[model samples]
Target: MAHELIYMDNSATSPVDEEVLKEMLPYFNEKFGNASTLYRLGVDAKKALDKARQQVADLINADVDEITFTSGGTESDNMAIKGVALSEIQKATDKNPRNHIITTTIEHPAVLETCKFLEKFGFEVTYLPVDEDGLISLDDLENAIKESTILITIMHSNNEIGTIQPTKEIGEIARKHNVLFHSDAVQSAGKIPVDVKDQNIDILSLSGHKINGPKGIGAIYIKKGVRFEVFMHGGGQEKGLRSGTENMPGIVGLGKAAELARENLETRMQHNKEIRDALIEKVTSQIKDAYVNGSLEKRLPNNVHFRFSGIEGESLILRLDNEGIDGATGSACSTHDLKGSHVLAAIGVKPALSHGSLRLSIGPENSIDDVDYIVASIKKVVDYLRELSPLWDNETDEYIGDRFEKPLEDEDIDRY
Candidate 1:
């Protein structure tokens, strides 16, 4: 008999919703027109795009004009970071060159790498460190700000460990210092409440695929009156901020997905939380020497991350795949890299423990049965891999168990 397949990698990407697909179908042929054109077909496409903008705006509690569609989260991150930096530099006087950006060490590569890229252009960057619970200190962020500090970009929720950052506090700090604040909300937008206005966020990035919409479509919310230079150049589209032919079908799909997400956010969050809590409870209780990563109480409702000693995460993932279960070790974007997760390292996870990390993010489609199956399958896979591990001796098991049961020592946490 074929093994039943269970998918628990929603943080990496989710399956497109049926309703979102239905909303996109007609745009392929019937409503196919360049939104930039002036004909009837073009006008219809333009109207669809406008409606989508409103949908995205409403979801984030932003003005309709603030939404700028992009290719994906990476593009949105790049546009927000670079756009703000360049815009500030242009407006800077001889004595006030705003060339510095502030971001956390645990940020997604899209944000981290963008900050790094700016460093090559004579821009300075401060990568604030996170604690063992994957939370950054508001004091550290404030101290990092200087006269050259132009923008502060951070992720709303961690992709690997699922720790939700205190973006509202960070936003207030930015506002007080007169700095532009941008957050990559790709992981938190649909799963949690993200009010740009309430958080005092000047800009935010979100992806469609992360919210059960089609891939290759995302948006950046730029608060009105926030000065930002254009990143792309072409026909004056997206108010000349992003210049290209709009992806009407993808936009419509994303809009519908956002709308549905808003309507069902509370119910979906509860469902995900139950499955996540159940899986975590079962796996930790049944599997010896297992411990969760990040702060349990402040994490995303769908995320459950854990680490097991004596086995590599990749090996466990392969073993679980044989049992028809799918999950991930770290960000899907960096899965090809053999190094330990930067997010884990930033949170002070030892290299050995980081190598064995596993991230299981539940979604609306995952049920209690699926959670049970995942727990069982993971337990089996970890046991099998542990047996093959050279470090899996009698003493090693006891040590691993003690490490999980006891509190972490001050020396255990690494600082950047």
Candidate 2:
């Protein structure tokens, strides 16, 4: 009972599993050898790196050679976008035109900023819009494609809202048009089943820390036939695409994490969903006028988002921290930005409600007791904050008494 710091922020990151930590310990001391060297230690390190590559590739049904290790998700995205841009210009045959990239306005900064940088070099970018449910319409995506479009980069799942995009449809569109497609699966990889081959992903990005692995390591899966220029160039490592000395320990840790995640995908997914649903159910049942933000049907198994009106999300997160519950107000990267989440605002959430948005993402290691603790803490915090508001006039205390058995008497309950 004492070890009860409830963590509901798996979307931001997760604690490295004890086994994964053990696997990485060797590279820090006894096995500290440059993967590019020719000695025995180096040989062992190189083999470990290669095996790790296969592990990551296996998770996504990609070829081992297709996966290139990067610092993390951001670098993978930058490499995907910038690498394609440079490669296109260098090898543009005929009047194929080196012009534009099509992406959604709701993309993560990794994709958004990369598109902005490519624009500085005379390339055009079209940022498509998303509907109120955080789903980008297929028709809008179709209209955005241009004659000079070189790539389409979108996220597989929204980090804040947990809305899973129609990646398969988008991939099909890209492939039909002969344009490249890249999906940043940093949030979706371990949370859901992702097969790059089945999705027809030209390029994919995933981070290690998201799947109970060590931080500072990620992978980019470039389809075997796809051509992308090198982002990191030096030694002949990574087939000359990435040249730095490999992070053997981090890679080993990543491999172990990936393997474990794949092996337990179904079981972990079911357990996480049960815990997540309990959190969502308990919060809405006990709190007044609280609701889940994003598509309930097409969402991550462990994600539960909420927009608690009349309270600042940053304040709620701080309050939750005091209650020994760790969660988030949107992405960890935007904690200090003070802009109140462009992702939430993009889905047409009001500025006031958007300011109070919180994302509670669960991990496989968490338990029902953890969810119950989080729910209880949230009920107390939200009730306290709502009491302070002069605008709290429509509070309810029925707790869905009879509606639980009936076939949804109240239409608005599902929306909540």
Could you list the CA RMSD of all candidates, in the order they appear?
A: 3.1, 6.4
For model 1, what is the C-alpha lDDT against the true structure?
Answer: 0.89
List candidate 2 segments past 4 Å from native. 1-3, 91-96, 390-416
Model 1 — which ten-residue stretch has the worst lDDT?
A: 407-416
Over all chains combined, what TM-score does candidate 2 have?
0.92
TM-score of each: 0.95, 0.92
Estimate, for each residue in 19-126, the C-alpha lDDT of model 2 and write its tens digit: 899989999999998888899999989988988999999998898889999889999999999999988887555576667888876778888888888888888888
Worst 10 residues of 2 by lDDT: 407-416
Best by TM-score: 1
lDDT of 1 at 222: 95
Residues 151-203 of candidate 1: C-alpha lDDT, one tens digit per residue: 99988999999999999999999999999999999999989999999998999
